[model samples]
Target chain A: MMNQTKFEELCASFALGALDDNEKQELLRELEESRPEQLETLKSYMDTAEHLPAGVEQTDPPEHIRAAIFKEIGAAPATEQQQDEATPPRQIAPPAWIRAAAVFLAAVCLVLLYFTLNLNSERIELAETVEQQRFEILDLRDRVQVAERYLEIIGSRNTYLVSMDGLEPSPSGFGRVFYDPESRAAILQVANLPASPPDKDYQLWVIREGTPVSAGLFSLDVDDQKRYFVLEDFFEEDFEGVDAVAITLEPEGGVPQPTGDMFLLGSPS
Target chain B: MFILFALLKKLTGDAQEEAELLIAVAGKDQQALGRLYDLYKRLLFSLCVSILKDRHEAEELLQEIFVQVWQKAAAYNPEKGTAYTWLVSLTRNRAIDRIRSKSWKNQQITDSDPDNKILELIPTEGSNPLHVTVAKQRSTMIQQFLNKIPDEQRSVLTAAYFEGFSQSEIADQTGLPLGTVKSRMRQGLLKLKEMLSGKEDQI
Candidate 1:
């Protein structure tokens, strides 16, 4: 069986996409033998990977797409206008008050029903407004917590920051790795790196004894340039023997070692 | 056929209703399917177009998605993931499959520009606030979060995410060893999980 550390590493790959057949079998085995907490952690990673697409550019699909979907589902197209206002009830509850002489009163009931429908629609609108507010509150709370953790990490005395400078491929590229050996909390911030192609990724490496060990893989921020990434407990070991840190372009997910051009490299003073 | 109006008439007033809607659809309630479609069509379509980079293909894929949703709705468990995640994840997987297919490459000449930078995205208007809020805030938070992650981490995450590269594929494409690819994937995803886990996606 792989150790806990390796299992966690596999969780990341599992969250990203398909795994090689061997790795997939191993992961499936681990999942079967793992505890609930381990499963929860794995779930969290999957959730994060799934949510990552929220940042992509949003475009409205053409109207016919809706018609097409409905048809594919063996249904009529639900037009935008058809959904703008609630459709009249397919069958209003039997007009119980109706009698030959009570026609007028029944009409009154009909009008009352219309008003009630409108009121119900308004209620839905209000409910949506309330939901939006709740989301905002949750959002604010999340941001605050993230900020607090960030401050705590930065304030820790054990934390040290190292600077990496651009190399020939990206002379303007630069990066910083802030790590706290005690808490294993780490953050990486970088900018000005050339973008990787679709099938490639940037891999970070830690060099000790003139050999590079994989740090991680990353990409240039597609929307905004600066990237600030944090890991809760990233360090598997103290960097007592580490000599330098560097970044290189590699295959999409990343390689076990650096085989690409170095874009950024740094050494601790 | 799911009647949109009838579906609205059946609202349970639960604050976050996507899960409930999905459940209802699993029972073959046409109305629930209609409601779900109205709620997510735009967002899903946008994601589809972004990946396939062609509206025609995106739309075709999208139609197939809903059909699949109707057929496979029973397999979705709210406990496993949120309705939003389930839908988006499903769409992403399907879209990726299409883009990576041999047929797609055979007919395609243009490629996604490697040099192109993704611009800030604003969701198109008209989504119900209840449906739109979390996704909207998530969008903003995601953009902000993306800005804070390291470039190397972002690249690999994006490659797996947008380009749908498997770890082995990534290693093969970049000439890196499989072990390094796994490390990067692990590192990038762990940090992202930290960011997303702070708030429970309360419906």
Candidate 2:
């Protein structure tokens, strides 16, 4: 039973992520009951953490990430075109046939140029130049697409869905983990789990016997279908434990090692 | 004497004008982009290093971020934030994304084999420092402030700031819970902000 000031102090702890689960739940409950002022302050404070590293500014994004974004964009135009077909054509848009004609003309010109320029040359040199130019065009087109899509993905920061296969127990069982490393958070979306008794909850372990750490307690939804569990704690080093990792039915919060019946197992490998 | 004073003011005005000019280049002007690169490369590189923690990765990320600015200049909304703020966010997000990715994480721990040659090829921090306007003295002050935090907090803060972890990631690495990690980071930052603000007063 913490008071308002204590709860506020704990909010600072919550914002810093220093609070344990019980403490965290308590603070969250308090936040729910308390005035909006505390919540606002907490949100602003947390948001600032995102920008506090402002003293350091990246001069640029990696060429690879840019390339990946471009690739995503480049692949999207066809999808966009299909979607656009369902609607009435806009007045400002270029006619599809005209655009197609232009593309055909460009291709013809490219073929002619290819033949004329390579008339006296060996096949290899001519092929290399054309391939290089083709890649360059492809890359440029991809970049244009990324520019269009950037705004849409901007709000969905720091979330990733990674699929993993079961390493043992039910090796066939597959699952996805929605991870946000920025928040040091992950949510397991287990497709299936072995049935366990009421006395035991499925304890999630990061894996590796001595190194295996407790992630948290979890159970499948009423359908015994998908289970969602929050990542409790982990280390970059704990990734070694990732292989052949198994979930087992245990008491709450999970035991240090696998003590009960194996429920689900997964390996990133 | 009056003319000299006015001339100095005008020169200062030109610096602001110069920044605007660079921003425009970043928008659609290639030469302007080159000039902006000339002006800010070193500072940006250092910032990237401070966060990316890997020189090669930072270098690559830096190039990509700039190209993005060039392509997306039309999308740049001046009202939302400064170019500097936008660029910082862009770079940080990419770096953090890389750091947290399973591929990158696996590479970091497993690829213990040192790239001695690559390490040598990469510019040492001070050796080829960018010629940006970030005063060495101010940078030193900031560095000192960084030193004041406990090593554990500093590690997590550095990881979060540069590598782009949410509160949860910090907790994961430090064996703390999501809530605790967020609180620690907020408290840590509040302290640094106060300290830096106080330092400004003293100055």
Candidate 3:
């Protein structure tokens, strides 16, 4: 056991983080068992020493540093709504059993339908119907898997969700982007968007430090105003310095840059 | 003097804001983390740069510190000290860790010497008004307190605190006896404690 005199001798150095590893461990051990009065004295010294760095003038780092940090952390810059939510442990994994059960039930129903249709129809028609049903089941299974993947990404701690609002002339529309930098995955969900002409498409852009890079062009099926687009590899490189996300109306194939008017814009708060 | 008082009042107000940001950070609010980063990045970066003497390394370390803050904000206890104290301690400790690491020693001289590098971390344009005011007040108070100590004693404290020098390191740097360096450091801290506590009582 160290004596009180030796403990007192090390207080200032300890506060400065200048002690060697062994001395630091010893001081911490002593501190854990020290009396209230002794603890208070030590704390006072630490409190004063901590203020020494305030002597340095405040300096602002380069603006890009903030964006770089946000990218590295795999979190979308916080938005006002997110700030209001202030939820702890924002990522919640959905129950795996629930998804598995739904997939199993769908497959069973499709198999039963194939057999029942065969019993009620002409052989040739029944065979065609069964083939179509099989294809539909496969499609449905693929869609479910995609939906589950979306849920997993959104439910992840690493995913950052940014809500985008429609610009002028499209005030009723809104969208959200869920991006996970680590996985290089992103999903774009748009609601109430005005139906686009067959020749035109909605293009998504990931704006990095004010330079907009085309994510891809997307088109809604059958004039539906809502759609969810998923990009398995949203960014070819690790998404760094991304400041904002925007959507613009463009030709069926997206241009190298945003040439048309923007319909939605969002920045990480 | 009037400006100083006004600045001090602003500093007090900003402390309350900082507390709220920390709470939000503890709740895992990324915006709050961003706000906290905006509030202290310069000061932390300046301290890192001063010790490491490499701008690129300092910026990298600054990002690492904030990442730690994002991960470990819950570990901060308000009762122990102010948010500023916690932030300064975290920055200094990380910078010191980098300085003492063997890899850093091998890479040292290729970068500039820390002793001669004047801190140019502060941006002259586009500074936040409240941030500027509070920083000015805190800097003024620390300088005033430091001025009260003897020059040699102050030098020892700076070497140990900012430069992360151990007593023997400070002795070698200053060409003084190791015993003299330790005594001066202890004396300087005691005087600073007295002065700061007296100020707190007045407040």
Best by lDDT: 3
Candidate 1 residue spans exceeding 4 A from truth: A87-269, B1-16, B102-134, B197-203
> Where's the lowest-lDDT run of ten residues in candidate 3 chain A?
A86-95
Itemize residue pairs with steric clashes in candidate 3: A59-B42
- Cα lDDT for residue B196, candidate 2: 55
Query: How would the docking of model 3 be graded?
Result: incorrect
Per-candidate Cα lDDT values, in order, are: 0.71, 0.53, 0.72
Greater DockQ among 1 and 3 belongs to 1
Q: Chain A TM-score per candidate? A: 0.51, 0.33, 0.51
Candidate 3 lDDT score relative to the true structure? 0.72
lDDT for A89 in candidate 2 is 44
**Model 2 / residue A204 / CA error / Å:** 99
* DockQ per candidate, 2 decimals: 0.21, 0.04, 0.18
Question: For residues A18-125, could you state the per-residue lDDT of candidate 2 as single tens digits?
Answer: 344455556656655656566555544443343344345334433344334334334222222332452224324688999999999999999999997788476778
DockQ for model 2?
A: 0.04
lDDT of 1 at B200: 28
TM-score of chain B of each: 0.66, 0.66, 0.67
